[model samples]
Target: MVNYRYLGNSGLKITELTYGNWITHASQVENAQATACVRAALDVGITSFDTADVYANTAAEEVLGEALKGERRESLEIFTKVFWPTGPGGANDMGLSRKHIMESIHGSLRRLQTDYVDLYQAHRYDYDTPLEETMSAFADLVHSGKVHYIGVSEWTADQIRAGAALAKELRIPFVSSQPQYSMLWRVIEDEVVPASREVGVSQIVWSPVAQGILTGKYKPGQAPPAGSRATDEKSGAKFIERFMREDILTRVQHLRPIADELGLTMAQLAIAWVLQNSNVAAAIIGASRPEQVRDNAKASGVEIPAELMTRIDEVLGDVVERDPARTVEAGPRSR
Candidate 1:
């Protein structure tokens, strides 16, 4: 069964495993397939669903809305993000600016077919917008009842600290931090995790399987499988290239014995490793098939022995990317 965790210090409870539609829902798969995957997630007891306004040019949100049309709205936590271009070409089309945020929330609500989103996040820090302006805008959204809690994704420790300070002054709940965290990507542990813990923000991590590399599907010195993400022409292949090296693939092969010993699949071991961190409130998984959701949801309540966890670190040493400075930021839009 999927267990729940308090989002940071907030009373809001979310499933430890969150089903997200990022690059899949409206882009790579059919509506029926996407709906099937969502149904599979729900059937497996996942109550938290995540999406973004910019995914597939805003089609992902609409697809998710249709999938959850008849469910009790209060029984689920629906999270969406703003801060990439989601509208027609214009200076005000993106970022965390009050104008864009205000405009984006309503567009999100309409597309989602919901009266309010449970957790609204800044998809990325808006370097072009002042922190106060962005915080004040989010504060207004919370006060207006359109959004319940606020969070940020892929932000640096410094960025999270600055935002948390303003969120405190505004008396708004900054309850979650979403980062790319996994057994291979330890970037969040050094800085983001510490900062978020200090500021009362739990992590809702993404790419917990390192884009499926940790699944041990891609073998070293072999061409990617026919339908695997590494073979996708659009975006998957590119997004997963960082961990596609032979060194990484070879080291990943060594995990099979550990997984076999624990009676868990490679994917489940990966997700369970991330959940071992107390600060990780949830780990987001994206699936294109209903079976994938069923398989991943089993990772929710798993616990890895400490000795095995340490062995995983030793086996994956050096290949792991732990630099806190690797946190990314987007450049201002060039008009």
Candidate 2:
């Protein structure tokens, strides 16, 4: 079973390994497969789920809702995000503006088949909308019982500081952050982690496997295995492209002995690596098959030793992306 961690300083405790449906829920797999994956997560004691309204253009939430239908709602932590175009790309369809946030929550609730989500997150910081407007709208949702807690995904350190200050003023729970974190990607370490630690916010990291590159299945100089995320152009191939270079793959192969020593698969080693961060409350894992969920869930309780941790850094040395500026560069400049 997966262990639990408190999100930030809050009373709520979530599974250390959260099951997120970013690309696999409705877009990459059939409904039956998606539901089975959710079941596998449940069977392994994962109670936290993460999703976004813009995933599969909103069908993902519906599928997740149906899959978790008979489970006890209070026993689960359901998180969803706003700030992307869902339902047609209209001018009013995206961003963290008051109008979009307000409308998007209602649609998310209706599709998720729940009265309130455990955590409602801003998918990204909206460059065009005033932060006050966005936080105030989120405050309204908390007041109305539509959302239990608030979070943001991929916001910069300064942005998190500003938002945490406003959240304190509004008296709403601003408790979590979701960022792309993995062995190969350490963009959040320098700035975001420190800022979040100061503000009582914990990280719910995504892509701990670097979109499956850390799994050690993608060879150094060969075509990606058929049906892999690297080949699935519609779902996540573009995201994995950054790490598909021969040099990166060759360096990744160096970590196999480390995994062998630990008796963990490369994927498990990668996921365990991120959870070693004290600020990370949870690492979100997505899966297309039920067994993938089961396999990755084993990473939850494994503790990588200090020397091996150091050696991992030594092995992946220059391949790691540790720049804090990449956080800003990765986010959108305009709504």
Best by lDDT: 2
Instruction: Mark the 10 consecutive residues where model 2 has the least summed lDDT.
Output: 326-335
Q: Please, what are the lDDT tens digits per residue for candidate 1 over residues 1-335?
A: 78999999999999999999999999999999999999999999999999999999999999999999999999999999999998787989988889999999998999999999999999988878898999999999999999999999988899999999999999999999899998888888988999999999999999999999999999999999998999998979988999999999999999989999889999999999999999999999999999999999889889899999989998998999988877863234331
Question: What's the lDDT of the predicted structure labeled candidate 2?
Answer: 0.95
Would you list the C-alpha lDDT of every candidate in the order shown?
A: 0.93, 0.95
- Give model 2's TM-score versus the native structure: 0.99
TM-score of each: 0.98, 0.99
Instruction: Predict model 1's lDDT versus the native.
Output: 0.93
State candidate 1's TM-score.
0.98
Expressed as tens digits, the lDDT of each residue in 82-103 for candidate 2 is 9989967889998999999999
